[model samples]
Target: MCVKCDNCGAEIGLDGVCKFCGTVLPPREPVAPPPVAPGWGTPPPRPVFSIPQPRVPVQQPVQAASPKSRWVAILLWLLLGYLGAHQFYAGKVGMGILYLFTFGLCGIGWVIDGVSLFAGSFRDRYGLPIRV
Candidate 1:
């Protein structure tokens, strides 16, 4: 048997509640009970789904920075970058030699290395990202 809404003529459930608009239905009239067979047994209750509800969003792992190249650059600048020592440390042998011949040109290469260190743009020989 189905319940219905008088205002909208929509079908409701036994709860006297309409699923569509959640409107309450009028009370049902009492009816006579039907006869039952002697051997019939009651059915089990329906199962409930309490949860396994999703909560927080997942995040990705953070990657670490490499320091090999940056340190070499700094070291070269300190030891010989006044004459492009650090350029050689960064694997640029030609520039290092040029700076060496030029007496480090007022230490310009060393200064650039200092700036690169602060800017977090210097990388290692393996091409990994450098951490500041």
Candidate 2:
């Protein structure tokens, strides 16, 4: 025997099911949709956004002054610069030898060394500035 499906209205065989629609012999109760909350028709509010700010760099602490004296180096450069006395005092042996041989690069290097010594930019063997 054959019967019609209650859900799809298709014909079924003796197994009590619809062949075309796959519906059972007896139809189940219809399911109702969930109830909507109040004001569900309105869309949600948009999210707020803000731009970031640039940050300032922090200042570093000052280093300790060198133990070598600037006045002593200046005096050596003034008196015996052609002989590289100031370079020897600053512990720059190679420059001292060069100055000793070349007469301070024909006196030009001697003048520049004196300028650097007075400007507080001359360094020692350890690379520390002889600013003191």
Candidate 3:
């Protein structure tokens, strides 16, 4: 009869041990022992398995604003800079409204605004760093 190796599950040579994992086996036959002798008792209990915790990766949020848009900024400056349109684009709503009501009355404020927008000193509504 044939026997399968317990270590690798391979078919073993009928006369010897398995070649793959070097597992030994006894030939099929009942052994007539010298008899007698029996002792010891139950085996000890096995330890329970302890599971390890998995690590999680951290994620960063992205910035939402661009630093400046020259064309749009210039348009606001030309058309509504008197109305503080440029200031509004730069997230300065309060100042924009001030200019809107004043109608560029001083003219000086609008000129400063044009320079601010061109220089990238402006920020978007979110107050985040502006991308080019």
Best by TM-score: 2
Displacement of residue 131 (Cα, Å) in model 3 is 4.9
Scored by lDDT, model 2 comes in at 0.85
Q: What's the TM-score of every candidate structure?
A: 0.38, 0.56, 0.42
Can you write out model 1's per-residue Cα lDDT over 1-132, one digit (the tens) per residue? 666677777888778888777898668688977856666666657899897988988888876766455665666666666777566655566766877787765566557667876676765545555563
Global fold similarity of model 2 (TM-score): 0.56
Note the residue pairs that clash in candidate 2: none
User: Against the unseen true structure, what C-alpha lDDT does each candidate score?
Assistant: 0.67, 0.85, 0.74
Model 3 Cα shift for residue 24 (angstroms): 89
- lDDT of each residue in 1-132, candidate 2, tens digit only: 345677787787777677888766655466797877888866678898987888878889887666889999899999999999989998999999999999999999998888888788888888889986
Worst 10-residue lDDT window for candidate 1 reads 123-132
| lDDT of model 2 at position 49 | 91
For candidate 3, what is the total of clashing residue pairs?
1
Model 1, runs deviating above 4 Å: 1-67, 123-132
Full ranking by lDDT: 2, 3, 1
Best by lDDT: 2
Q: In model 2, which runs have C-alpha deviations exceeding 4 angstroms?
A: 1-59
Give all candidate RMSDs, comma-separated.
Answer: 11.5, 10.2, 14.9
- The better candidate by lDDT, 1 or 2, is 2
